[model samples]
Target: MKTTITVNGEARALDLDTRVTLLDALREHLGLKGSKKGCDHGQCGACTVLVNGVRINACLSLAVMHDGDEVTTIEGIGTEAALHPLQQAFLTQDAFQCGYCTPGQICSAVGMLQEAAQNWPSQATEDLTAAIALTDAEIRERMSGNICRCSAYPQILAAIRDVAGEPA
Candidate 1:
């Protein structure tokens, strides 16, 4: 299958097998290794990437399904020269220990923030009609899909709170 996906703000044209996953395409073909294949299943959020501003597990998605879509990997969110606020916060807070899940955590955080800004309610939300309060519970519920094996939840929460304008 010939697919063209706009990755990291650049159009990448590739002829890939129909079974090629978006994760494989990004990591193997495009050389974007930031998105890791943790569980190789949707159970782990390590393959999370932003597709059309929404986060999904890249390992669970086919590359052909994302043709003509704008995909943002960790590389797209920010660079070493100018880190994204979440990236910088993660650093300042030491949110990652093994660092295997940091990329997905950051990407998921970006999409999760956008979702919260749009008044999307999570299971922890007490009031569906009101603006999100972004309480600790709310943050935890919203980010439940991403798991850090190193158990850096506290620091991760601090990083997210810092980016969300909440006191750590």
Candidate 2:
């Protein structure tokens, strides 16, 4: 199957098997290695990427399923010299220890921030109708999917809180 997915602000056309997962398509064909494949299963958020502005596990979805969709990998989030706010926060806050899960953590944080800005509710939310607060509990719950084996969770939560304009 041939499909075009807008990744990191560029349209990439590839002829691949429909069974190919988006994670494979990005890393193998597109050479976008920011999204890691920590676990082939969707249990880990290591393959998280933004599909049409929403975060999804690339490993869980087929490339063909997202034809013409806008996909944002960690590479698309910022340049090497100029990091995205979340990226910068992660750096200054030392949010990552091993750094393997940083890409997914950052990508998921980006989506989570967007969701919070839009007043979206998460499992940690107390009141659905009230303005969503960027609390540490909320951040933790929202970022629960991305596992940091190094256990730099406090720093990760701090980075997210900093980017979300909350106190550390």
Candidate 3:
């Protein structure tokens, strides 16, 4: 089947099987390999990407379903010369050890910030205050899906808090 999806602000047209996951389509078909294939079951979140400014596991979604949706991968965030705020914070904080999950972590953080900015309430948000205060628990809960085998949770949370402009 022929499918066309906008990826990283580019219109990608391809003929693919119905079973092709978005991760494979991005890495194999469109040559956008930033989204990793960690668990291939949506458990690892290594294939995390943004669709319409929301984070999702690419391995659990089909490519053809995102025909007109805007998908943003790690490459779309920033370049080596100009890194996004979250990216810069991650680098400055030394968030990752092995660096395998860095791309997904960065992308997830970008989407997470947007989600936070939108005042999306979480389970722990008992009081719908004027503005949501980014707490360490909130960050951890929001990023629970993205696992880090290196156990770099402290640095990752620090980086996110820094980008979020919240005192830790």
Candidate 4:
């Protein structure tokens, strides 16, 4: 099947197998290998990417299904000269240890920040009607999906909070 999707602000057209996972499409087809294949399962969140402005497990989605959609991988977020705030925060906070999951974590944090801006509620939000504060608990809850096997939760939370304009 022929699939065309905008990736990293560029249009990428490729002939792909119908069952090709989005992660594979990005890494293999488009040669955008920042999104890693950790467990090859959605549970790990190592292949998380922003599709249509929402964070999703790229490993769980098919490339053909996202035709014409906008996708942002870690490479799309920022460059080395001008790092995204979250990326910079991650560096300053030393949020990553092994660094295998940093890309996913940064991508997830990008989408998570958008979610928070829209007042999206997470499991930690007690009052659904109230604005969700970027509390430590809230950050943890929202970031639960992106697991860091290095157990860098404290630094990760600090980086996220820093980008969120909260006291780190």
Q: Quick one: best lDDT, which candidate?
A: 1
TM-score: model 2 vs. ground truth:
0.97
Q: All models: lDDT?
A: 0.95, 0.93, 0.90, 0.93
Instruction: Pick the winner on lDDT between candidates 3 and 4.
Output: 4
Off by over 4 Å in 1: none
C-alpha lDDT (0 to 100) for residue 162 of candidate 1: 94
Candidate 4 lDDT tens digits, 1-168? 999999998998899989899999999988999999999889988899999999999999999999999999999998999999999999999999999999999999999999999999999999999988888998999998888999999999999998899653
Sequence-dependent TM-score of model 3: 0.96
Count of clashes, each model: 0, 0, 0, 0
* Candidate 3 error regions (>4 Å): 128-130
Model 3 Cα shift for residue 59 (angstroms): 0.5
What lDDT does model 3 reach? 0.90
Clashing pairs in 4: none
Model 1 lDDT per residue over 1-168, tens place? 999999999999999999999999999999999999999989879999999999999999999999999999999987889999999999999999999999999999999999999999999999889998888899999999999999999999999999998543
Give one digit per residue, the lDDT tens place, for model 3 in 1-168.
Answer: 888888889888889999999899999988888889999998988899999889999999998888788999998999999998898999899999998888899889999888889999776576877677888888998998999999999999999999898776
- Candidate 2, which segments miss by more than 4 Å at Cα? none
lDDT of 2 by residue, 50-145 (tens): 999999999999999999999999999989998999999999999888899999999999999998999999999999999998889999999999
- In candidate 4, which residue ranges exceed 4 Å CA deviation? none
